[model samples]
Target: MAKNTGKAYEEFVRTIQQSLITAEGMSHLKNIEVETNKKLTDRNGIERQFDVYWEFDLGGYVYKTVIECKDYASSITVEKIDAFIGKTADIPGLRLIYATKTGYQSGASIKAEQHKIDLLIVREADEREWTAEDGTPLIKTIQLNIVALTSPRITSFAPNVDTDWLEKQKDLNADIINHAFTSSLNNEIFISNESTGHKFSLFDLSHLLLKKIPDIQYGKGTFSEELDNSYLETKAGDIKIKIKGYKLDYEYHAPITTSSVIDYSKDLLGIVEKYNTGTKQMIFKDGKIK
Candidate 1:
């Protein structure tokens, strides 16, 4: 099957013009109108049908632009260019443009140049011409990588204590770890070291764990951190306990990776610009001039 390369000539040009008006961020351009079989009379009261047309306001004056799209497989000839000039001659201040896929003959080019009729080759883009002035290759499609982050969570936090000092405190319970932790006003587990007046909590641990890693975990994972020669202040009569280390039941939340390809080939490929009449060609891609 043939590739889905394009649409009807008139509608295709209309679509391209509309997109450029929006993409170029112009405020004075009107919507492109496609009148394939419909006859719309101009100011001269003459019925003149067009393939595609639009208008724009500049220099305090509105300029009417029209495109005569020819879908013939063969190159346009001088006869066709002459016919177009005669057809549009009566219209005053009209900006006439002729577009085709195949191209035009030398005679047609001479006639079009003499008449100042813009000629363009608008069709599917080929690799040969898909390049910028800086020798950078243009692409019809691009792959975009997407990343979503999930913050790591703490499942458990236990402070180490000195058994010798535990026996001296009569107010301590048999399960010292349970009595050592207290829930904050926000219901988060919180504790502090009396020796250094440092506060430690589950929220703090979550942030600290992230800082220790080079990158976030790829998927569901676990981690345990331990410290030596440390002390923890407990809720049991604000008792200060010497801790050998800390036991943390931690699993880092995984970062999800996804990718998508944006194909501008279908969105736009042909009609880089009007190449005839000494007009320079340009293509807009990836939000920058490639």
Candidate 2:
């Protein structure tokens, strides 16, 4: 099980490594090779295996980078960073990166900075403002329908007309109305009109519906409205429906931002140390590191 887990993690690291390289515009580096579980012999003839290894050339100089993947539940310690630094000393010009799922300990970050090694934390991207095709901030919208029944209860709420629009409604009604329920107030029923493509979840739809149509049980008859961009219609028969149109929801992948490089020919260590100290001071004052 441990072996299988390690292989799975190696594959994941390889995939992310390739993506990061390409996304960061490092693909121009010649002889760009990314490998998993690559073995190398040290000066003392001791074999060391790396989780993910990469090498490339830039400006006529070839550089090697060794990435260590730690799929640990807890944060990585400074001891691990020290061991990795020792390995780097054995192999000259070996740029080191420590990737951890749970991030690094406080000392680990300082140690990594001292060694001029990169520390990367793997996790889900946080929710942020995202724009759509027309530069409008993408939003999730939900439309729901609440029906008032007089005598008979609605067992099913299928689309009435056989038009193309109504045919689409038939399938949508099946998807949403399956969760419909009959209330005790004069056999009145509440059915939501849920259609995909809006990226809204069912809980979000329900919350929006309650806010928009607060008095669902007071209405006597059916009503319909045609707004500028949306429509709300109602039909009465064996099953009454007060619902709105729906569209399919789509998933969007955000583009990665480019990273700035620190030139090693300059005072790289001094710059890194100053930056780290400034970051910690900022965190102490503003309650955030970045």
Candidate 3:
């Protein structure tokens, strides 16, 4: 459990860092490389491990950053910050950033700021975090309407054949009425409207019927689309057929309405850390929201 928890935290940090480097978010950054559990040798030739390490190239120069994460239940102390400072001293040219689950102790902030290290409290956002300057909490509620559609069942299919056109063509079989323009249950044949020249397949017709299902509040319903001047292509030749229509029966249950207010602490994929004066981002546990 502890190993899984640590890995989860590392990924959470790496994922949010990716979001930050995007053009829509941070500026003066591009072509970033981020990783977790990166180990690098210090000036003393001793290897040091970083919870999260990232670098970016901008204007022909590369900026290296190392982030240390502490998933403690309690606030971080100044002693921890001191240890982090010493840990990074030998690893020169590194921008230092530290993150924790809770927050920093009273003097920890001053100490970290003095050393030019940024401190962040990364965790789930709470309702109290969303508030106006006057302390009035903003409500995060949404109303969703889910309309349910039943499987469409085709009741009957009738294809009208153009016998006049068939009579003109001598090579076509005269008994085309029975074999031609027939509906294939698997939608294997393509047909078109003789007058409008609109092509349709059995699958397309099914989709059309699904789209045409009437918006009814409740109960079962029967519907159909009138199709005319339709023709089917056959092995003998193109057979002009007029389709009366496709009749279908379907049921539409009443829409289900749900009203919900977002609880960031419990409902989201992960937590977010808002800096005092920087880009705001959410760090998901799985490293992504979508």
Model 1 scores what on Cα lDDT?
0.66
In the range 185-244, model 3's lDDT, one tens digit per residue, is 436555676787787665555556545654533455666566666666543446544345
Question: How good is model 2 by TM-score?
Answer: 0.43
lDDT for 224 in candidate 3 is 54
**Off by more than 4 A, model 1:** 1-7, 22-26, 29-46, 56-62, 129-154, 167-229, 233-240, 246-257, 262-270, 277-290
lDDT of 1 at 34: 34
Per-residue lDDT for 223 in model 3? 67
Tens-digit per-residue lDDT, 1-290, candidate 2 = 34536566666667666655665667876546689989888888888888899888778877888888777888889999988888767777788887765667889889899888877754322212234456776433333444432321222232232244445555457434443323222123323333421333223433343344454443232222221222222222244333343322212223334444432222111110122333211111111222
lDDT of 1 by residue, 182-258 (tens): 43321244445555667765577677777776675644545655555456554333645566666666667666899
RMSD of each: 6.1, 19.5, 8.6
lDDT of candidate 3 at residue 72, scale 0 to 100? 83
Q: Which residue runs of candidate 3 sit more than 4 Å off their true CA positions?
A: 1-5, 23-30, 129-137, 146-290
Candidate 3: RMSD to truth: 8.6
lDDT at 77, model 1: 97
The residue pairs in collision within model 2 are 196-247, 196-248, 196-249, 197-248, 197-249
User: Lowest summed-lDDT stretch of 10 residues in model 2?
Assistant: 264-273
